[model samples]
Every structure is written in C-alpha cells, then in structure tokens.
Target: MKHQTSQLEFSRPLQVDRVPRLGSVEKLSAEPKELKALAKRMKLPALHALSAELRATPWRGGGLKVEGHLTADIEQVSVISLEAFRETVSLPVSRYFLPAGAVNDNDQEDDADPISNGWVDLGEVVAEILALDLDPYPRKPGEAFEEHVEIEAEPKPESPFAVLARRKGD
Candidate 1:
C-alpha cells in the first residue's frame, strides 16, 4: 500500500476518556516526514520507518492499560567506529496509565509508572520507548576497539658512576 504522510506531530495526544468502547484498538504508522522529524528531535542519525499497534483497556478500577508494539528501522552513529549504521528497534509497550494525582507520591511503584494528566499519546510513548531502546553507544557489527600504542626507543641515560669515570679520565 502507498503510505501517505501525516501532519500529526510525533507527540500527538489521544484522549482515552473519549473512546467509545472498553476494548479499543488503534493502529498507527508514522509518516515519513513525521518519523524524520521525530528522529531529528531524538538526535538519531536517521529514521527509515516507524509503526505501532496499540490497545487500550480499563484496569485497576479507574486506571487504563495501554499496550502496544513499536517497530522501527533507524540509523545511528557508532561510538567506537564513528561510522553510521542501520538498526532495527522492536519494543513491547505495556504500562498502566492513571490520571495525574490519582495516586499518592508515596504509593508510586517502579513498574506502574503512571502517565500524567488525563491523556495518553501513543505516539509520544512510542517515541520515548524507541529512544530508550536505542543503543547509547551503537557500534557496527564486528567492530571492535583495538588499542595501538606506539613505543619510541631512546638511548638509556648514563649512570652516575659512568659519568664520574669519564670526568676522572678527562
């Protein structure tokens, strides 16, 4: 299918409270320009493709569970070789999003990091996940650091005794 570019920003927000069904599914693919802009925002070398399939379900009384899968092809600069190379990023999105101030600060948990405010933007989440999953120091396949230290040969310093003997002979 011919992919059409979208005007939506990478952080496009979706109001979950406006959904018509309890089990709603949204499939989204980033336009090439959007992906390129997102990559630029993320400081990535390049972005070839980005797409996702997300599902929203009510959970834990008032909270919502946003789950999805993000697949992307990107290019990054290798920290070791200093060359650019392509990579594939695939991340499973699973997180419970609660309205801001719904939970007390003391009750927060690591795994249940909730979304702030009343909206959940799958686009922003996907971008964040992609950024997190990317290698901070990407290196090309089979690229390894090889340290090459050069040693310069120099004449050994003359001993004090040898200097003294030369002075006495003089």
Candidate 2:
C-alpha cells in the first residue's frame, strides 16, 4: 500500500515571560578546548542536516509565541529541556555580576561575590544538567523514550583551591 503524505498548517498563541538570567560571564565561559571537544563529539553532520531542514521552513512571528505539539520523543525532549534549563540557570549567573547602570565596562572588578548570594546554586544546576545522557534525535511530536535519573553517588564538595591544585601526582 502507498501512503500519501499531506501537509497541515496550524497557528497557536503563546506568552513568553522575560527570559531568566543564568550565569556570570566568568562562569559561563566554557574553556575553548572543552567547547571544541563537545562540538566534535556532537558530530556536526546531523545538526547541519537538521539546520538545513529548519532553514527551509518559514517561521511566522516577530517577538514570541507558544504552541502545543501532538508528539515528541522523551529522550530528545529531555535533551532540549536540559539545554533550556542550562541556559536559564547560566544566564542569570552571568548577569549577576553586571555593573549597575547601562554603561558596559569589560574590566570592572568590584570584588563583590554574587555566588555567595545564591548564584553558586546555578552552577550546581548546570553541572547536573550536563551530567544527563540524552538522545540527539527525538520524534517531532509524540514519542516515548526511557528516562533514567542517575544520582551522583558521591557529591563532591566545592573548593576554591581546587582550581589551583594539580591532579594527584601531576
């Protein structure tokens, strides 16, 4: 039997709250080597293909809107959700250190620690999101995938000196 495919168009309304700030510039700055590794591991070809497909589609709207979808794969959805969580947690961490007023100063050192005032918690959240394993491709609308929560068996306490310490016997 031959299956005929038909195109369907629909519109939905959505409201966006102000995007949450995530992290401080100093905190959000991923090491160049680390980013390169992540990009390499992601295997750009699939992403490139997806980008081409998305680019071919027309997006309607200026500011923002929300819509509901009928299907989605849980694993893929989890990855996207985790990424959004990372952004939300990271952006504010970055913004907390911004100097008062609109003037932008790249070299200002106020010595005020925003982390002491709850910003550090975001770092932990980011770390947790990064730890999860997720599928790269998910069914577009409705789909099912296994969900696994891997609890950190041993939580490592944060240390300011840890950054300066070399690996054991290094």
lDDT of model 2, residue 83: 28
* TM-score, structure 1 vs. true: 0.73
Model 2, position 164, has a per-residue lDDT of 52
TM-score of each: 0.73, 0.18
In the range 1-170, model 1's lDDT, one tens digit per residue, is 22232443575566656654576887878898888898887798789999889888876655778798989999989888789999887889887777666666677563454654556777877888888888777899888889977798798999999999999999
- Which sections of candidate 1 miss by over 4 Å? 1-8, 20-22, 110-117, 148-170
Q: For residue 143, give model 1's deviation from the true position in Å.
A: 1.5
- In angstroms, the error of model 1 at 47 is 0.9
Question: What's the true lDDT of residue 129 in model 2?
Answer: 35
Superposed Cα deviation of residue 40, candidate 2 (Å): 3.9
State the C-alpha lDDT per candidate: 0.77, 0.25
By summed lDDT, the worst window of 10 consecutive residues in model 2 runs over 49-58
